[model samples]
Target: SMFVTNSSFCTESKECLEYLLVCKTDEYEVRHYSPTRWVSTDAEAYFMGVGAAMAFRRLFQYINGANEGGFQMEMTAPVLVKIPEETRMWEPAVYSLGFPLPAAYQEKPPAPTSNKLYFSEMPEMDVYVRSYGGWMLSVTSRLHAHLLTEELGRVGASYNHSYHYGVGYDSPLKLLNRHNEVWYVSEGEGSFTSQRLV
Candidate 1:
């Protein structure tokens, strides 16, 4: 049972996605996550918040019994929003938001009723993470992502620049102690120089 229900940041979820802590620096943490399955949806918008909101609703419905089996599922923590690195002001970006399928549904989850929704299988990989407080709005998410990239550059960390993830562990109803993160995928195997957080 890799998935744990109790994590410091995942206060309200019944199940939280699991990851192995690889290293930590003053500004960020490095985590290794195993391959996991998720129910995902994509939305196109000029801002991350707008896209994520739409995508979230779609995904929420799926877990609430909008699937083929009409089977309901519990919510999971650390919902992931894949954000592309490059975007022009005039153009809208496509945001892919995902909720990790519960262990029971990971292997054979109900199929999504919407065409925009699908199942995504993430590969085992490492990521550079920066935690933040408050709402995961477009501005805040981008700000933290920029900050994380700066720290990564300063440390000479090798990571993927093409895209990153905006991770959230709380629901909108929870106002206090809201935890959010921005993640930059590691470049490849052996790309990190691991050292325990002191």
Candidate 2:
């Protein structure tokens, strides 16, 4: 229903539905990649806490209208991040937080005042998704991602590791029933199927 920005974690927002499940977990759903406009910058590992919040705020204001494209856009799930690699941990790593504009606005969305922002469309594709709970601390996010990777490997699924996504659906203010996820792009060409994880 509304989006609230807090740098310690992903941006917060409310939705009429309990945050779209996207697809059933372990279900191997094929979803058309949605379109989102995002901003990217390098942040030292130690500063991810504050840096991320600042970046989100800048982008958030673009839609909220610090310039011209002023509209209270609905926030989307799994604040997609191009999950960084550990070997480069000591050095500054790039983080991207996308605002997946609704399809109607996506084609002609407002321009961001900041050059740090960019827009792109996610092509339709199949993906492996895993759900988790709790705050998205670096360690916690990494663990869920690792588990998702393991599950993909166990199922003999092909995945692209260059990028991994972390999705969050609950506001930090909400204390219980929080939903977060780790997503991997699937390499399979067949039509998407929903498989029960159990």
TM-score of each: 0.94, 0.72
- TM-score quality measure for candidate 2: 0.72
Model 2's alpha-carbon lDDT is: 0.56
Query: Per-residue lDDT of 37-110 in model 1, one digit per residue for the tens?
Result: 77888899999889999999999999999999999898998899989989899999998888889999988988
lDDT of 2 by residue, 67-112 (tens): 3456666655445555654536466666656555544454577666
Best-matching candidate per TM-score: 1
- Backbone clash pairs in model 1 (N, Cα, C under 3 Å; residues 3+ apart or in different chains), count: 0
Each candidate's lDDT (Cα)?
0.87, 0.56
